[model samples]
Target chain A: MNNNEKDKKSLIDDYKLHITILFISTISLGIGTINIPLINGFNLVLLPIMYSLFLAVLFYIYKPAKWINKSQSKTCAEILLILISPLIVKLAIASGENIDILFNVGPALLLKELGTVGTVIIGLPIALLLGFKREAIGMTSSICREPQLAVLIDKYGFDSDEVKGFFVVYLIGIVLGTIFISILTNILCYLVPLHPYSYALASGIGSTSMNVAAVSSLIALYPALSDKLLALSGLSNMISVVFSIYVYIFISLPLTEKLYEKFHKYFN
Target chain B: MEIDLSFKMVSEWIGILLIFSVMAAIGNYVGYQYPFVESLIGMFILCLISLVGLIVEKLLPFDNIPAIIYISLIGLFVALPWFPLADLIIYYTSKVDLISLTTVLLAYAGVAMGKDLGSFKKVGLRGIIVTFAVIFGTYLGSAVIAHIALAYTGMI
Candidate 1:
């Protein structure tokens, strides 16, 4: 092919990539627009984020035709990081709007984060009992988001069993975590006696989508406090994102490692 | 050493963000019933803020910090009372719904997940079981603690 033909072909491929993403994204949003009501104003809302994720996964895995190749998929991953910046800005602005309210509840927000250790205390035992060995340390260390994944990778390298464990939890966290937390928050809202505000703070366990899903579920239950709950969730999420790496490196990782050494023999 | 960034690279980044903003504006209009023009304007401002954040990440001498930190700080700076455009920024941006933005980001996240699915299946049933435990532990643990703290503070 001549130079002109090659240039034209590449240009078409570029537009194809953009067009495909835009097409699928718009459809997911369209589907997400539908809000089906469940019993008594508690709507069964599978968020657009959830549907979009599942749609893309299914499209890539099941399609007979190779619409999106490996290189394009890699490009999509790179763009994901850039795309998240605007969302981060939105949450930050939300925090700014409610900074005064959040400041008033500073102690609660600060103290609630300590509960993240529950993952190790509760999850470590279960993971160990499942005969996971050292993998239990990585799996139970944190929620296994990208930040925690980075910690494990930095210390143990990307190919370690720890990272394998990290990927397991990370995959689960993204795919089903939102739906799981949404239902759990709804159930806890009725079963547990905690105030709605506590639920709001609790909903912010670092992952933005899961936090939104959980908080929105709680908001559906208590519409009157929607604004307050959202603000609190945003602040809680920000704190979790900012401080979680330190917590993982200094506290969770070390603690899980020590515990894994002690408990591995018993499980085996 | 000279910065290695090129005009082509920066323009590509900006172009992607603009397309994303357009999708978000449409989503905001359809889902939240927000005005399309207002949402578009709001998202444009947000795109600019995100661009600044990305640039700051490049310019900073230090490494390891996530760009979200800079983005959040910029958002807060513009929204805070001290900023001259705080109210205007807040008003227009609020018109753009948060969930709509997630839809766009996660679409990309989903597309990215295509390659990882093969490895994902290898995780086995045990990994899935432990995953549930870890996720539940974090959410429940945080909620319980926040509950106790709220009770102790008499803020409940």
Candidate 2:
């Protein structure tokens, strides 16, 4: 083969890994949309799980591609977040006609319904009683999502104790939050009656991926309410991104610190 | 063949759409029960949206806002209930399932965690404890308010 043909062959080979992932992921997602009956009687659609396993399998057996590398994967995940962000807006825009869910008490309902405030109020004394360190309290009082990282860095400066504390929690959140948030929100959808749209908005408290997981799971359950769920979730996530950091750092952290001190002296 | 990298990227995107569209068709026959054409159409609109997103980034005075943010806001406006195209656009956009969009993304996230195992281990036991406490606290906090709200609304 000539040099040009040889170069083209090498390029095609390089593209093979990426092409495989895309095709498999699409097929897996398609399958995920269907329910398969198990021998034990429960029908399972395990598409998300299947898709994840596909990636995991590739990571273990195939050559690790750049897109799957830690840093590169971070970029890919962020791109996914940005891509989905618009869909949420579209959902809200469409649903807004039905009830203007974004403006019509959506924020109040999401906060009240999701109980973001209650997480701090009830958990503060308990965390103090558990003897959590001040750093831990700083992390705990906030949902400690990605936006908080920037505010924490700016306020405390990097290398401070609080930064380390935030890093510790942030790491754990990244590892665990991505998965459990979907399951937790799914359980909430089943156990509560606060409206699917409320849960859609509530899911926006963390990263876009988490929001997508929670919203998709709920959408899977309540297909009829899909539009409102999308709109409310999009709006709620934007609010969480814009405002939750300020609320958590300024108000929640100080309040938790004072409570921890009061309890430490008394209990210790 | 000294291939153009940008052209290669575009072809790759098209390849992805082709694969997804084919799978979606199979899904229709296999039991997914959604229209097969919708996935392809939805992706087409997404491509248009992304193109506008890039333009918005170039035109805007401020650089802080990300292109995705602008793209999404524009999407929101386009679908705004009163807009001329709102209803038509929402109908098309709504067809593609969120699960389809998130499934592969989550898969990539899983791969990322796999790739980052070393970083996670560095955090050690303290990270685990802090994470547990944070998760517990947040859930407990939300549960309390949820209970009262449900009670007040008589939803229970």
The best candidate by TM-score is 1
Off-target runs (Cα >4 Å) in candidate 2 are A1-14, A30-50, A53-108, A117-268, B1-31, B111-114, B124-131, B144-156
Candidate 1: list runs displaced more than 4 Å: A1-13, A33-43, A124-268
Model 1 lDDT per residue over B1-156, tens place:
445455555676688788888889988877778999999999999999989987877678656655566776788778877789988989999999877877676666666767777766766788878988898888888889998998888888
| Candidate 1 local Cα displacement, residue A192, angstroms | 8.3
Report model 2's TM-score to 2 decimal places.
0.53
> In candidate 1, which residue pairs clash?
none
Best-performing candidate as measured by lDDT = 1
TM-score of each model, paired residue for residue: 0.74, 0.53
Number of the top candidate by DockQ?
A: 1
Candidate 2 lDDT tens digits, A78-105: 3333334433443434443444643655
For model 1 chain A, give the 10-residue run with minimal summed lDDT. A1-10
lDDT string, candidate 1, A55-102, tens digits: 777777776436677666666755665677777677677667766755
